[model samples]
Target chain A: MSLLAAGGLAVGYRRGRRAPLTLVADVDLSLAAGELVCLVGPNGAGKSTLLRTLAGLQRPLAGRVTLAGADLHAMDARERAQRLATVWTGPVEVGLMAARELVALGRHPHTGWSGRLRAADEAAIDAALAAVDAAELAWQPVDQLSDGQRQKINIARALAQEPQLLLLDEPAAWLDLARRAEIMALLQRLARQQGCAVLLSSHDLELALRHADRLWLMSGDGTLRAGAPEDLALGGALSTAFRSAGLHYDALEGKFVSLQPRSGGPTVALHGSGTAASWTRRALERGGYRVCEPGCERAARAAVKVLQQGWELRLGSSRRRCESLESLLSALAAAPVD
Target chain B: MIRAQWRWPGATLLPGRLHSDPLQRQRLRRALLQGGLLCLVLALFLLSLMLGSVNIPPDEVLRSLSRAGAGESAWERIVLLIRLPKALTALLAGAALGVSGLLMQTLFRNPLAGPYVLGISSGASLGVALVLLGAGGTLGVTLVAGLGLGGSLALAGAAMTGAALVLLLVLLVARAVGSNMTLLVLGVMLGFLTSALVSMLLYFSVPEQVQAYVNWSFGSFGTVSWRELRVMAPLLLAGLTLAALLAKPLDALLPGEQVAQGLGLNVRRARLQVMLATAVLAGTVTAFCGPVGFLGIAVPHLCRSLAGTSCHRTLLPACMLCGAALALVAALVAELPGSNLVLPLNAVMALLGAPVVIHVLLRRRNLRRVFAS
Candidate 1:
C-alpha cells in the first residue's frame, strides 16, 4: 500500500540574527492510498513549506518523512524519484520543449545510463497526457499554452512519473474557476483510479472541502488539524482555522457566508415563526436597530407590513422613512438623535 | 478512433498499417547516420593529409605511409613529418573543442556559453603570456616559445581553475538574479575582465615576445609535437568521453535544476563533472592552438540546427563531426599555396562563423515561429 507519513515535522527559517520564525510546528499527518488530501491555511501558515519538505526539496530541521515504508531522507535520489513526484508553481525556463518531452522527463529514473526512452516509457507518457486531457497538446510547446493549460501539462508531467505519492504546491493558483474545478476533479480521479496518494495545497477552501477526501487544516496558532473535510467543518475547525471575521460558518450550507446587515429602519410587525423571525431579528440588531413586536407604541410609530410588499413607514419614527429594508436603516442613522 | 490513431502515430495502432514505429525507427536511423558521418569524417581527415601547400600524390602518400622513407624525399617528409601529425591534431582538437562547447552550453543552459565566453581561453592566454613575456629575455625566443609547452599545461590547469571559479560565481548569482540573461551578462563581463588583463600584458611586452604571443593567440594545429600528442590525445579522448556519458543527465538538466534533481540526477555532481570535462577539453585545445575562436561556440549551434533537436544524444556527436569538418576546412584554406604566409585559423573561422551568428540572430523570431507552427 502506498502511504505518505510525516511525524513531528518542524520547519523554521531565520530572517536574520534573531530567533527563528517557526512555520510548521510538531505536525503529524498520514495519507493512505486512494486518498486525496487538500492543505488549506492562511498566509504564512506553512502550507507551502510543508509541501516542499514532503517533496524532498526542503529538509526539515527536525522530524522525518516517509513514503510507502521507505525513509525519504535515506533513499537514493533515483529511488526517491521513482516513488514520489512533485509539481511546484514556477516557470520552467526551457521554453521550446514540447509537452510530450516535458512529460517524458518523468521517466528519467527508469531510463538506463543512456537515458534512451523505451517503448514502455512512451506509452506511459501518452497515458499521462491522456489522464490530464493534454494529449492534444502533446506536440505543442508548453510556452504556447495558456496559464491554465500549462498548469495541466505540468500536472501531466508529474503524473507521468507514475509515482505512488504526488505532491503539488498550489496547483490551482493560476487557474480560473472552471479550470480550477477541472484540475481538482482530475486530481481526485487520479487518486481513485490509480490509487495514488495525492496532496495539494490550495487557497480555494470551498472547492477543497467539496472535493478532497481529507483535509489538513493549518490553524493560525501553530497547530495542524487533520480529518475528513466534513468532520473538520463540523468541528468548527475550518472557521477557526481561516479566522475570517466577516464570515460565519453555515452548518446547513456547509460553507461560509457573508452576514449582511438588514437595511430597513427597526420598524416592523413580526408575524413569522421563531426560526425566520429570530434570524431577521439578529440581522436587524447587527444592523444597529431595536426590534419591536406587533402593536407596541414603538411598533405603532413604525411602518406596517403589507401583504406582498414587506414593510413601509407610518407616523413619527425618528424622522426616518422606511422605503426598503436597506434604505430605512441608513435613514434611521441619518435622523436626529432624540 | 482512426483519426486518433493516425494523429498520434506512436500512441495507438492502426489496422493494416504495418510501418515500423516512426520514433523508434527514426532513432535507429539517426544512430546509423551518425555512425556513417563519423566514418566519413575519418576518411576526409585522411584525405586532408594529402592536400596541403605541397600537394603529395595520393599514391605517393600511401607509399610513404607503408614505409616512412621509401617515397620521394619531399613527399616522405611532408606526409610523415607535416601532414599526418597536423591533420590528426586538428581532428582531435576540433572534436574536443566541439564537445566542450556543447557541454558548456547545455550545463549553463545558455546558447552563448562556451570556452571563450567563460574566460577559460583568457586564463590560458595569461599562462602563455607569463611564459612568453616574463621568461623571454633570460630564455632565448625559441626557449621562451618552448616554454609554451609547459605554459599550455599550466594554462589548462589555470583555465580549469578559472572555469570553476566562474561556475561558482554564476551559481551564486543565479540565486540572487532570477534571469538567465543576467547570468550570461555576468559571464561575459568576467571574460572581458580577463581579456583586458591580457591586453595590458601584451602592451608592456617586448617586440620579440609580442610576436611570439601573437602567433600563439592566432592558434594553429601544427604546434603539437609527437611527444605532446602522446599527452594531449588521451586527455582529449577522456574529456569527450565524459561529456558523451553526461548526455542523458545534461538533457534532464535542460528543463531546470529542480526538475533534474527530481529526476534522480545528483545535480551538484553532474554539474561538477560537466565543468571539469569542459575545462579539460577547452584547456587542452587552447594550450595547443592559442585560443581558437568560433569553433567551440558556433559548431554546437550548427549541429543543433542540422539535427533539429536539442537532445544531447544526437547533438554531441553531430557537433564533434561538424567541428572537425569545419576546422579541417579552415586548416585547408589557411594552407592554400598562393599565400606562402599561412592565414591565421581564427580569421578563417570568423569569416564563416560571424555570418552564421548574425543570421541566427536576425532570423531568430521567424525560426521560433516556424518551430511553433
Candidate 2:
C-alpha cells in the first residue's frame, strides 16, 4: 500500500566519505496511494531537505528510501521518474516552452529516447492541464506565466508524469491566501481522483490543516511527527513544531495567533458569542488588555458585555456604553483599571 | 496575447481539439524558412565564387559548375579549385559554429556563451603558436606558405590537438563542478591562462615566426583548402547530428540541468555529449577556418529572435542556416568584393557582431524569462 517509504532516513550534505552533515535524522515516513500528506515546519526545519531526500534529488546521509518496494536511489532516473514525481518551487527557467510542452516533459519515462510526444502523451498533458485548472494556460509560454499560474502548471507537469507517488516542495510559497487554499484543494483532489499519493511541504498551516488528509510535522530539533491533521493539531504536535515563543496555535480556529506576551496589565473579561466576541477579543488583545474569561459575563472583576445594542463596559462604579468596536476599544483603553 | 501567438509552435493541438494541425503547420512554416535560407546560402555561395581577386561572370561560374568534363578554363579552375572550396569551408564553418554556439548557450544557460567561450579558440591559437613561434624553424609554416601542403596540414593538426586538449580540460571541469556558471568562468580563466602562455611564446619567437602567428590569428575561411574540406565536412556533420539528436534533452535543459534530470534525463551523460558535440563543431572549425568569430555567438541569437521561439527542433536548423548565411556575408565583407585587398576576418565580424552583442545587452529581452521560472 505504501507508494513511497523512507525508513530511518538521515538527510544532509556529504563531505567526501567521512560523514554527512545530517540535518534531519532518522525520518520514518510512508505515503500510501490515494492520500494527501502535507509537511509543515518552521523555517530551516529540514522540510525541503527531507522532501529532496525522498524525491531522490539528494543522497540521504543514512537509511533507505524505497518506491514500490525497490531501493529509490538504485533505480535509473527514467524508472524512478515513472514511480515518483516531484514538483519543486518555481520560477523554473524556461525558454518560451509552452505550458503544454512543459507538461509533456513528464512523458520522458514513458516516451522513447527521442522524446517525441505521442497521442497518449498529449491526452495526459491535456488531462493534467484540465486537472490543475490551467487549461487556458496550456498554450501560453511558461516564461510569461504569472507566479500563481506557473505553480498550477508545475502541478500539471507533475500530474503528467503519471507517477504513483507525487512529492512537492513549497509549491505555493508565493501565492496569495485565496490562491494558496485553492492550490492545496487542487492537490487534495489530484490525490483522490488520480489515485496517487501526494506529499507536499508548505508553511501555510491553515490551508494545510484544512485540506491535507494527514500531516508530517518537521520540527527545528530535526524530528518528524506524522498523523491525521486534526489529531496532530489537537495533540499539540503542530503547535510544538511551528509555534515559537511569541506565537501560539489556536486549536478551535485552526490557525496561529500571537501569544499575549504576558504583559502585567489588568485583565478584562469580554463577554459575547460569535464574530462579535472574536473581534472584541482581538481588539482587547491589540489594545494591550489581558482579555480573559471570554464569553463569561458573570465573572465580575471589570468586564465588558456585548449586547445587540453595543459594548457595555462595567468598571467598578463606572459604566460606559459604546456602539462601535473602535469606541469600545477607546473606552476600554481610557477606563480606569480595577 | 503576444505570448499566445509566440508559443503557437508548441501549442497542444490535441486530436479533434479546437487548435488544428500544429505539427503540419510548423513543418510547412519551417520548410519555407529553411528554403528561403538555403536559397540565401546558395546565392552567397555563388557570389563567393564569382567575386574575388579575379571576378568571374555568373554565367561562366554556372557553366563551370554544370559542365565539369569540359576543358577547364581559368574561371573554372578558379571557381572549382579555389572559390568553391573556400565558400564551402565558410558555409560548413558557419553552420558548425552556429550549432556549437547554440549548444554552448543552452548548456551554460547563458546568452554570452559561444563556441570559444570554453577557451577553444585560445587553445587552437596556443597550438598554432607553439608550432609557429616555439618550433618555427623546424615546422617552417610561413604566413605565405600557410596554404601549402606541409605547413597548412601541420598547422591545422597542431590547432586541433590544442583545441582537443582545452576541450578535454573544460569537459573535465564541467564534470567536477556542479554549477554551469562555475564551468563557464573556468573556461574564461582557461582562456586567460592559454593567452598568457601564447604571449610568452610570441615574445621569444623570431620576427618571421611572429608574423606568421599574427597572420594566422587574423582568422580566415579561405584557410581550408579542398583537402581540409574533406576532413572538416564530415566532422561538422557529425557535430550537427549530435545537436539534432540532443534537441529534446536540450529543450528540457533550457530551464537548466536540474529540470532536465527531473524530466528523466541523465544529466551527466547529456552534458558529456554536449561537450563532445561542441568540441567537434568548434574544434574542427577552428582548425580549418582559424576561429571564425561572431557567427557562432550571434547567429543563434539572430535565429531565435526571428523565429520567436527557442524550440531546438526549429532553432537548431535555423541556427545552421543563419550561421551559414552570416558567415557567407562575413566572408563577402572580408573579401572587400571590388578591391583586391581582404580585411581581417575578425575585424569584419567585430564590426558586425559587436553591435548585436551590445544591442542584446542594451535591450535585455527575455533574459529573466529564461533565468527565473
Candidate 3:
C-alpha cells in the first residue's frame, strides 16, 4: 500500500466574492514507502500548490487524499503531522536557535504540552543530525551557518519528525552545484535506508533525472506526467514538456541541447572526440564559429584539429598550434573573416 | 584530544550535564541571570519601601511589612500605607507590560511591537478620557455604574473594554495585512487616531476634570491604592498565567505562521489567546497606572539580549523578573530617594529604557537575531 495517495485533486485559491482560480486539477499521485519521487516543473507551474495539497496543508478543491487507508484531510493536525512532514523553500527565521534546537523542533507532534524533549526525542534529534552529517554543527547558531549547512539542518529537522512520508517544495533551489547534488544524494539515501517516502520539487532537472527514483513532471500546461526518468525521456515527454523554440532535450546525452547562433562569417572544421573535444566544440560555438561535419570539412575556410596536447588551427594553408581554447579563439579572431 | 570548555557569561558549572552540553550551559546561565535579577528586585523593593517622600529605616520598613497593624508611628504609617502599595503596583505593572510586549512581538513577528507601540494603551486612555472627562457623560457613567463599580473600578472596566475592542480590531487588521512593517504603521496610525479623540474630549471637559486627566496622563505607580491592588493583582496574574501556557505555541510561531501550522499548532486559536492575554495585561496596568511607557517595549529586549535566546519558555520568565526589577529601579529613581521632589514615572522610564533600545538597534546584528525578518 502507498504511504500517501491523492486522487482527482484540484488545487487553487479563492478570491473575494468570485470563482476560485484553479491552477491545477484532475491529478492522481501516490508515494510508496521507501520511494523517492522528484516533482519537476517550470516556475509557477503549480508545483508548490500540488505539494501543499498532498501534504494536507491546504484543502483540496475537489477530491480526497488518503494516508494509510485513512482520509488525510479528515485527520487532526497532530495526527497528520505524526505521519507526514513538509519542508518549504523559503528561508527560516530562527533567532538565537542552535542547529540542534531547530532540528529538535521537528518532534513537535510527539512532545507534550510544554515541548520538553524526552530521551527518545533527543535520540531522534541526534540520529537525524548524524543522518545529515551535521553533528559537528549541532552547537552552532543557525544564523551563523552557511547556506548549504542551513539546508542540511532543515532536512535534519524534517527527519526528526520521524514521518512515513515527507514532502519538500524546492529544497535545493538555492545551492551550489556540489551542494545540490549532495542534497539529492542525501534525500535518496534517507528514503531507502529509513523506508520513508520522499517527494521534493526541484528546478534542477539534470540532478532530478539522475538521482530521482521516479519523476512527476508537471508541464507548462498544468498536466503531470509521472514515470521513471529514462522512460519519460525515451517517451519524448521531457522534450515536449520543456519545449522551447531555442532548445530541445538530448535524449541520448540526458541533457538539454542548444547552440548559439553562428556568426555567419567564420566557418571552422573542428575534429575531435572525448571531453576536450566537446568543450572545444562549446568554445567554438560560443565564439560564433560554424563547426562543419565530415562532408563539409574539406570545403571549410578554417580547419581546427584537436590534438593530444594542443589545438592545431589551419587557416588557408597556414598552421598555428594554440595552447588553449582561449588562444585558439584569439587565433581565430586574428584570422581574416571571410 | 582534550575538549576545551569555555565559560558562557554567568554560567556556573553544574555536575552531570554542564561538561559538554551547550544547552545545559545556556540553561544554567539563564538561571544565574534570573537569580541575580530576583535578588536585585528584592533589594530594590526594600529600597522603594524605605526611601520615599518620608524616609523610613530598613528595619522599620521590615517591621511594618512583617507585623500587621504595627504601632501607628509616622514611619510605619508611611511604609505600610503609602510606599508598599506603590512598590507592589510598580512590580505588577512592569511584569504585565513586559509579558504583554513579548506576546505582541511574537504574534506580529516584529521586534518593535508592544502594547503602547501597537496603540492598545491609547485605546485604554481613550476609555479613561471618556469616563473622567465626562465626554460620554451618562452613557459611560451608567455603563460602569450599572456593573456596581465606582471610581477606579469603573475606570478599570472601561479601559479593559476599550483595550479588548482595539485589540480585536488590530487582530482583524492583522489578518488582512501581510507585512509586519505595514501592521506596525497601521498600529501607530490607530494610536494617533485614539489620542486625537482623547485630546478632543479633553478640550470640552471642565478645568477640574481636565486636571484629573492630565495628572493621570503623566503616568504614576503611586496612584494605585491598596483597594485597587485587589482588582489589579488577579487580572495581571491571570494574564501572566495565560501567557505562560502559550510558551510552546509562541516558540512554534517563531519560524512563520504557515510553518507553525505545519508543526500542528492551532495558529488561529493561539493567536487569539495571545491577544487576549495582551489585552488583559496591558489594559489592567494602564487603567491603574495610567499608560506607563517604556517598560513594555524595553523589558523584553533586555531579557532577550541578556538571555541570548528567543525561546518563549525562558523568555517569559526572564521578562517577568527583569521587568519587575527595572520598574522598581525606575520607581526608586522617580522617588528622588532622599528629597521630597518626585520625578514623573514615564520620564524616569524613558531615561532608563531608551538607551537599552538604542543599544539594541545600533548593534544591528543583535536586532537581526531578535527579529524574524
Please tell me which predicted candidate would have the highest lDDT against the true structure.
3
Q: Taking the tens digit of each residue's C-alpha lDDT, what string does model 1 give over B286-335?
A: 86777897888888776665555667878888888877877887787777
Q: Model 3 chain B — which ten-residue stretch has the worst lDDT?
A: B140-149
- Please state the error at residue B128 of candidate 1 in Å: 1.1
| B226: Cα error in model 2, Å | 0.5
Indicate the docking level reached by candidate 1: acceptable
TM-score of structure candidate 3: 0.92
lDDT of 1 by residue, A215-290 (tens): 9989767899999999998889887876554556676778776656545654544444455456555655666566
| Candidate 3 lDDT by residue in tens digits, B1-373 | 2345665533464475675687777777777888888888889888899887777778878888887544687887788778989899999888899999998888888776887766788999888888877645555445434422256677777777777778888889877775556767887999999999999988887666676677667788876778889889999999999999998899888887777877888777787788778888988899888888788888888788777788888899889988888889889899897788888889899997788767865764576766746
Which sections of candidate 1 miss by over 4 Å? A14-19, A95-98, A135-150, A234-236, A243-338, B1-20, B32-47, B57-59, B66-69, B144-197, B357-373
What is the clash count for each candidate, in the order shown? Answer: 3, 2, 0
Candidate order by decreasing DockQ: 3, 2, 1
What is the C-alpha lDDT profile of model 2 across B1-373, one tens digit per residue?
Answer: 8776675454555343434555455556667788888899989988998998888899999899897647977888988888898899888888999999999989988877899989999999999888888875645445346554557777889999999999988888888888878888999999999999999998887777878888888888877777878888999899889888998888878766766777778888888898899889998888877867777878777777666567787889999998888888888888988788999997898798768756874576755555442
Candidate 2 residues lying further than 4 Å off, grouped into runs, are A25-27, A243-246, A258-260, A266-277, A292-338, B1-31, B136-148, B354-364, B371-373
Error of 3 at B126 (Å): 0.9
Q: How many angstroms is residue B118 displaced in model 1 relative to the true structure, after the best TM-score fit?
A: 4.4
Supply candidate 3's per-residue lDDT for A118: 92
**How many angstroms is residue A36 displaced in model 2 relative to the true structure, after the best TM-score fit?**
0.5
lDDT of 1 at A184: 92
| Fold similarity of candidate 2's chain A to the true chain A, as a TM-score | 0.85
